[model samples]
Target: MPGPDYCDVDVLRRIRRRSLAALRADVEPVPPEVFAGFLPGWHEVGRLRGVDGVAAAVETLAGTPVAASALESLVLPARVVDYRPEYLDELTTSGEVVWIGAGASATGLEGWVALVPADAVADLAPDRRVEITELSQPARWILEIFAARPAGVGRFARELAPEVAARAGATAPPLPPPTPAEFAEAIWELAWAGFLSNDSLAPLRARLGGSAHPATLAAPATRATRATRAPRARSGLRSMRARRRIDAPSTTAPHLSGRWSLVPGAGEATARILGRSLALVDRDGVVLRGSVPEGLPGGFGSVYRVLARAEESGQVRRGYFVEGLGAAQFALPEAVERLRAAAAPAPGPPSGLVLAATDPAQAYGAALAWPEACGPGGHRPGRKIGACVALVAGRLVFYLERGGRSLLTFTTEPGVLAIAADALAEAIRAGRLGRITLTTIDGAAALTGAAATAALRGAGFVPHPRGLRLRGAMSRPESVSPAAETTAASGPGAGSGPGSGLESAGGCVDA
Candidate 1:
């Protein structure tokens, strides 16, 4: 009987379809030739009659589930062979396309066509040598060129064109550099074989840098940069006034010069007097003395009340109202000392703190101290104490009130906060809490500056008119469960044991 016809067009189409599908799914598509060897009387066929015969044989067995499964399971060994330009040309002439499955922007066709000698392939890991190869003269020439310059083929070709010409020998015509398209193709092929180097593309990139599409080169302004520039345009007067206030020369302003000290007798009486004045003082204790600006709210009495409360809570250490400049000055010893330490030069990497306290009292104490320890100008002295502390990356990251309000957050190294935020986020997700909110005063601008705000933003905090808030990552429940809702509503550190408040209403208090 005549050997089974192996050149049927229908069989070729089916094989091609299956191969494409396999490739699309990232599964290695076995060449039809592998299956041809298993077919009955396959050896009887006169020769491997081009690609058609292999396809036909594979198609004939397609209907047989056992045969098809065998073919599907077959994994051909990947062999590395010398690169041959002729093979590529032949494949192209036959309307065959090779998918590179990698970026090929640089050395182009030259890298692909570069010869990988048998010895070179042998030197590689066995599994790395993906295709069996037949050597060709062109492949050898390209390999020699590449060997001459190990840095990259494109750079060698461009920067050392004369050397390449000398390598070609007197009788051989000067080797013309590959065109862009040819180079791209070579790069693609080389990349598929894992031989392409990004450095090799440097020369091409340098040459084409100016030629990139305008749209591709364009970059939008970053949010942080935009945020910094936004307020200037909308409130030029306010910006200028603020700048003047900070930069204005002062006489006998001890706080401005960072030379101020707490007055010996300054206490609750002094706090009452200074609070009434609503004075703005530098961290050093120099009060910005001047007439109260028009339209400024919160008279001295209201200010006094707040200061008295803070003093009673041990947040304010000392205060004074200077009649000479019509200004009030307050001293927070802890805050001032902290500022001084920050300015003092220190050797070695700064120390870091990471705490996870199970005792609510301890956690609360730390939370109260955080504002002074890490706040910008030192903590504002007094504010509502935090109820619970959130541990992020095993560190006490921030404290929250009973209502899920963020009272204070401790600063860490440059990138630590982001990590901690992510950890907290994971905890919230695991706990299935819908969300958490952090409340801060704009007056706390001294502590929570732009950088801290930006970091918080990265950690999924969004600024609302009220304050910065972060929502839970867990999906909202369809029907709110009463127990779960109550737990979430109670906030992070709602139920505290005894002695959760300040140990003594005396020294500096923060947060």
Candidate 2:
């Protein structure tokens, strides 16, 4: 008979976890080559890593795609103690694969990123890199400056920092910089825009320099340290104040001054990008067209035909695998098996999980419609940074907005809310939920309703003047300015913001 109807809460939860490799146990480490083979989709580069983004590390190595940090893991001697050198050496050269941004935008941060294998890359008659035509003037100017004189990224950051700063005098300087974490972000954008490319990712695997001091060479960590700390201190590869594009490099930023060379890119690169997107679909097993991300490729429309071909070839199966979407879903035979296998209930009552709202495993906003908002004000959730959803036993309980201050209840069931609250609290206690200080729930005071208060308290939270909070994450006073708060849970916590009390307390803001 046909497989289980395939539209149930258990199937959703299991598939989500399976897609993200968030099963009770951790996924075993796979070589980069093998890992890239099953690459799911481009990860929106930023601090959003848990169960979302491309990857935090390949060791989690499940569905999350490779990231710069993951790339670094394969290189850094300090971090490589866990894996065999040969396993890590798979991509040692620039030839095996190439990392490029989806070219979603020349400015937007949603430049989904991924690494494509060399053979698929070579399939394009011209090339596979995503093409960019909407490049911002500033990014174009910066590219010109660098093109004229290829200097270190640090030097470019330093030069552009002042110019960008002067322009910001008109307003608040747009997205203020000195953000060193974005150094890799800028490289990501440039790579996608076709301004920065190398035959291999070798530049990241090894440090590069020209006329550098012996002391600077001796301390690679020092340069990276300064780069990371520069947003507050002011030095090292600074992100552009305007945010999406960069012009100059900050002083002292080292390791990538002259290593990565510039490239012209293919005239029309959609074929390669589309090919890779389909490749990811096969590897990922089950894929929704929307899951590929908009604007990553230059064009579309041939997906059904391609899937039909694959089906005829016995390469993939097409069916109503997921609920709440059009009937155009496709899955590999193995993916269907795994997804059905995932239908079984977990041995224990679900502990609950808080993962990135955009995490691919979450089918609500992507493959299915978001649950109805239960409270007064209508709530719509997006796959945004710092935004998260809490689930208990595959049921979406609540959605946390970006700042983490406001929350939307997906289910009004008091019992479900209680378990969800407990899960959130447990995650916080274990430091896995990140630091959240809920100010509002269902648009009302998060601690206002009796049920909410009971849920909060039952889950180990305390009634704070702000709303509800866990002592471990919220008790400590914050020192950073309101403007510097970030949304990456793996980063720091929020400090202050625009509202009164908890509203201004940097709700849901990641460090």
Candidate 3:
């Protein structure tokens, strides 16, 4: 048997039939590339899946009514073609087919082709071959130009050819300069590809019709500085125009305000990371205002410092950078008030309790409260200390770690301990920590007591037989009630008793 018919007409007809069958079958429609082998140089004008789809596409292309039956005969294989214009008359007269006319309005065509009746070829020589035209050199040039400076082309909507040519000359493979007509054709192709704006076509067409060469079209005078200065000047002009447009009162719409607000540029990755941390606080509508250390992971410290300085110098940059060391003490206005209320000194003297840190004063305070952990001389052990202080739900929670182990957690208010626990839970969920371990010995018991441990349990923590370890995948409680004030009795270094705890170890304390 003869191999499957690969003739152009047979292939196109099969493509249409299969494509229509796909529509009826509710399967994927055949793509235009399926016909690539049959029509080697022919570019796809449009593809219509079903009879209705075909009719609509043809009518749109022809800009006239297409008989439903004529479209139905094509049967959803409405494979439109772009051929050289020379065959338009022959193809139209010889076919029982839809001829949408050459794509003159769009491509400024050299020729055109159509779906001719298979029988029309009977009179032709058997050996004669139909040559499909490739995209003209100018069209390819235009594509390369668009590919090279997509941003610039988008920015400067008109006068594209020379700018494209000039830019391409700097980097692209050298080719003979295209004529104005060729440039127009290429631009029209680009517009068809949705690269150039449709509105640009009219003026470009007019200019091309008047000019012999693309050079005649008005462009910046070629100079050593033109390449550099022109873009900068254009950018400045564009910026000024944008500003003026913004400043100009909205006369067209009186109800709308003409005032333009400055929106910050795109934020850096560091800003996004910092935002995540801030979001944790912001979600609770809590303000965080204090001097936090610059030790956040992912170089957030440097990002914060840069942003904070920029904010101070009146540079309206993106991200949550405010003035302060590590830019850590920033808060929303509501959070600020909340923090102030939370940190407000009680009527009585300071609660001598203090969270131990590397600082001698704080360590001494901690040692005073818990004499068992301190030496006989009432001096705290000299151990490397790591601390993570976070503001959660309008309260500051401090976690102090000694020798890779969490020592104690101190909170400003009892009500916020749950929020602190939740923060730690979130950290655990993020895989920053394996489990939270809390020991009854050392400063752990003195800082966080039975009441605080209950809060951690409510926040998805399990009291390990050996120590307190948060459950890896515990469901977080919606809300946790404040535990009763748990503080160690005033002792040696206890200058005052502040809220202190032996909260759970591990989890996400060291930021």
Candidate 4:
């Protein structure tokens, strides 16, 4: 059965991920097209024989005996779409007018001959011979030569010369020697056809060097070299421009120098911070390249906003360009610092974070102090918040979090919360927090399922089942006050019980 057709973006991402892994593993896969069949309209040909036919065909056309081996060898490599029904009819007739010959420019004369079966010879024109020439040496040989080697006219010239010379009274045409330029062009053609990836083009480009037309053929490769030497480039380019903006130079500008921030405490620590201007451009580039992460805030609006900022800053002077959305999520502070050091100087770190505005007003308040106060990197200026809510199969699943927690946990499905449970358990063990209480308006099955099972056994945490009454009781309490309440409800209430918005049968627990 055929699989679902994946989107172009997903396919590119999977390919990139797979290729990167293979590189790390020290394995190089053959180009995708080799096994996938890059030759357009080409199909595998299989052999079939009707024994009575060959002897008569050879007698009529080649005027010699036809052996099965010779026929098999000749036709195996050549492609045939269909076999003529009367193929055996004209082959064996006495004075059989078995074949007709014609020449065409595309195939050469070097023309195709039909196998005329002997029994049908009386129906043939008197002057004809069985046209098994189509099945004979020349046609099959030419097809085989072209299929084996795929250089254009040059390949045909070299491979077909001896055969052409061997044909009756024919002098072989002089073979046109391929120039290095021609070879390079062929490489590029193959690359464009997806038979060669950009990674594989490196050595080819190095070989062509300055001779290759349009320096941009290797532009991506050149930028890679420059980026690997980026620290030096960053220093030199910084010394050259100093505080000046390096208006989007090309697709590579983001990788080299876009935004920068000094490492805190580690005097030598450098970070490549992506400023609003660069991030915007890089985001657009990422979309074009199809690497947009799912559930991240900002659609094309984010892109347009970035473009507007670039225009305002006079940063993006070029017509159009593409690049990736440089490492957005960072694990280590040092890595963030490294990124900052590599970045172009910005007025300040980009303030707006990229988050879904699930609870925009509250999330905004959280954003002002986020990352800086709660997470690794300091607070970035631009606040783009994305809420974690996905509509899977028409079910509205909300990813929830309480006040002052970087750990995102929410679930409509029990399996989805497994990662969060493990994380919560680890946090508790490390003394990062006290107790991780999950209060869901769910049935007993959720607590007994794999998520709870793993948490109880693997993480040594206890699972507490909560009742649905808390949800109803909290929703419309007869009397409640803003300041009078001390604890927050576990599920959803202003603030009254557990203080963290989590509620179970034992009472509200800090979510």
Candidate lDDT scores, in order, read 0.30, 0.46, 0.31, 0.26
What is candidate 1's TM-score against the reference?
A: 0.21
lDDT of 2 at 392: 65
Residue-wise lDDT of candidate 1 within 45-117, one digit each (tens)? 2233433433332222211111100111110000101222233223322323111111222322111111111
Off by over 4 Å in 1: 1-371, 376-386, 391-395, 432-434, 441-448, 473-511
Error of 1 at 110 (Å): 76
Backbone collision count in every prediction? Answer: 18, 24, 22, 62
Scored by lDDT, the top model is 2
Once fitted onto the true fold, the runs of candidate 4 whose alpha carbons sit more than 4 angstroms away are 1-275, 281-400, 403-420, 431-434, 441-457, 464-511
The alpha-carbon RMSD values of the candidates against the true structure, listed in the order shown, are 38.0, 14.5, 33.7, 34.1
What's the best-to-worst order under TM-score?
2, 3, 1, 4
- Candidate 3 local accuracy as lDDT? 0.31
* Model 3: per-residue Cα lDDT over 295-375, one tens digit each: 334444543554345334333222222212222433334433433344334464321111112221121221122223221
Candidate 3 residues lying further than 4 Å off, grouped into runs, are: 1-387, 400-404, 440-448, 471-511
TM-score per candidate, chains pooled: 0.21, 0.56, 0.22, 0.20
